[model samples]
Target: MNNPPSGGAGPDLSVTIAGIRFRNPVIAASGTFGYGREYQGLLDVSALGGICTKGLTLRPRPGNTGNRIHETPSGILNSIGLENPGIPAFLEKELPALRELGPVVIANLSGADPEEYAEGARILGASSIDMIELNISCPNVKAGGMAFGLDPEMAASVVGPVRRAAGGKPLMVKLSPNAPDLAAVARACVDAGADALSLVNTFKAMAIDIYRRKPVFDMVSAGLSGPAIRPIALRMVWELGNALELPLIGVGGIAGPEDALEFLLAGAAAVQVGSATFAHPAAMLETIRGIRDYMEKGAFLTVGELSIRQKSPRARDRSGNTGSPPQGG
Candidate 1:
């Protein structure tokens, strides 16, 4: 894998999360990048640090109906409801090509229940996928997604089963920003055997369609994502980084290289570019280039060094008073 494209002379932008070394720290967020094939002709998929497939479930779901997406000033609300082509179909059809896509392939796994999540993980555990992104924070789904993520005990209950079922594969739990106690949930996931954590899933939001005198989406609430959520997402990453020692993948409204640099500086080992990809397909690649440039200019040799959380005493002091207290008392 050490070829010209993967290996060049510059400040290394690569990041290693959960023992998986990505070529760079700019990954395509799940739901935005569909299985890495939809964007095959749009940009060089191999140039990405990683690709997270759409949220997958044990059984095929038709997803929610009636305006699953709505655009806002700086973000979009979505109620896709985990609509996906069951795990079996993904294993048979998508996994093969995804294996050849050249970037780290992370399966964004979700389900309606703990057992369903476990079964899906069991199936994926035997596959050749690079890592498993345990998505316990999907806000739009009513059944189990965010339900399992909101509380520390609830999150641990779900993570324990999936962890054992993952067959020792790297497990990175995606978190919901809506959780009342986000740090407690992170600590629970880690205690339950999670290797890494990604933060700031869309906030729960809604909009009214005055013309129809109804809601913009069938479900009254949907997941909010985009530049509108980036600042808050960065703060969440910063808070978690100060509280835990796990690798973090920051997601939410990351549109450009400067935005991504903010998350890394706030302590994210990697940043996932989502909504921006809809407007610019090469956003991730541009971010990768931008990060390399930033690193070179700052004399930061590795992605880990880009973190100002631990290296700066001021950041540490600020973190102590940021939000709620750190994980353990």
Candidate 2:
């Protein structure tokens, strides 16, 4: 892993999360990158922590009809509606091909209801996938009536069966910032059966075409992602870190090594790079390189060393003092 590519010198970037070993802390966020194979020609995908495939459903979905993706100032709004090729096709075809790719494979599953979620977990758990990320929350589709993530009770209830079906494979629940009380819901998920957690899927946002005087998305609202959501996500990740003993994977608006470091300091076991992948196909590789560079300069030996938390300068400044001097090089 010491070989240098177009990115930077790859250091000892390995880290273990929920007992799953990853070559690096940077994972390719789901939806942004297709089932890990799409970028085979770009760079080495295996160098990443893991490849999280697009959200999967029980059956194939045609997805939304019009204007599924729209670019925003600092981010992107999407209403892809969990479009997937269905689990059966994934098991028969995609899974085999993805295995040949390097790095760990994390299967992200979404279902119309609790039963489907349990079934998907049962099948995937028995497969070669390294982990299962339950989509208890996604903000794009309003037509589903309920996302199963908004209510702590519903989210908590769904995990037990999925955990049983998972057959001991690590189960990480994706969290929604749209929840009325995010921390409460997170606690519920942990108590129910989650081994780890990934969070801040996307904020519920909407756009307007002034000329048409109508919503830009056919679904009326879409999931907002990118650098725009990083601050809020950092806060939430910190809050969760304070409230739970479980590993947390931070997502939302992480565009560079600095952002990833912020999440780590706030207590994220690891962080995922999402919208940035759309702008730079090799972004994950670059992020891995950047993290290595930062770590080397700081004389950190591993990702666990990256979790050192510094006192907030804002709080100190408010109390009439400068912040703590920057520690890392």
Candidate 3:
């Protein structure tokens, strides 16, 4: 038998975020892909728009002591505590290999305070990394973790200096779902200096071991992610898209193309795959293929085309009601 349609490139999957063009809109999220080294020999790294490295700090961290990750009904709660080998090691060890392997490399930087954030950005910007993702939304740590992300002023305090430090490179701020006002916080980051925004980082969660009579994680609380947060993430993306004019990346619990499509239609410039990678090593590659197949079937030529189709007037409010103009006004 002849080749049974293994499939080749079908449509133009390229997407641009903050003036950076990615081969596809599906990018590997930080803290999950491990600096693009783990996925080596498993999938084409270059096929992705970019790779967001595990959240990096100024110094190496030992991470949480006790139980780290726990599987829930439809999601995973993690207390990894931003475990990383620090920025110096990443530059000296991981950056070269990733650059050689291809794909746009985005460095995810985190710090306990604004100074640390600026310093890390200043250092990473000097490297070959194509972009910097300021992970201000991490909820696992106790110090300045989500504290800097929840309030608009606090978000700006971290973003302004980092953006100035990373003047030459794209500086994207990752938004926290724990914030009382995600849209206001997003605006603050942009007004302060962020080049792009990524929304709906894992929700705050905790799991108790009833048999053990204690918390499952040493940190007492963890970040909940996976399919469980998809609906919330999608709603935020749609609202944030309506609020902000800059490029927004949708993330939370995307496991497949259908989830990504919701984000795209809601106004995301791209989607980041996180927890699903743990279950399937080739999840991102599969997502890319599925997206291409969906586009081809729908006769869609570009991601922008697909995104536009869903930007109609049928948008609903948080109450699940159509948001029509006021009749009395």
On TM-score, the candidate that comes out on top is 1
- Residue 186 Cα positional deviation in candidate 3, in Å, after optimal superposition: 0.6
List per-prediction Cα lDDT, in the order shown. 0.86, 0.81, 0.83
RMSD of 3: 6.3
Better of 1 and 3 by TM-score: 1
* Candidate 1 Cα outliers beyond 4 Å, as residue runs: 1-7, 311-329
Q: Model 3: per-residue lDDT, tens digit, 231-286? A: 99998988887786677889989998888887876767789999998997777877
Question: Ranking by TM-score, best first?
Answer: 1, 3, 2
Predicted structure 1, TM vs. truth = 0.92
TM per candidate comes to 0.92, 0.90, 0.91
Q: What is the number of residue pairs that collide in model 2?
A: 2
Give the range where candidate 3 is weakest over 10 consecutive residues by summed lDDT.
Answer: 320-329
Q: Rank the candidates by lDDT, best first.
A: 1, 3, 2
* Strongest candidate by lDDT: 1
Which ten contiguous residues of candidate 2 have the minimum total lDDT?
316-325
User: What is the alpha-carbon lDDT for the whole of candidate 2?
Assistant: 0.81
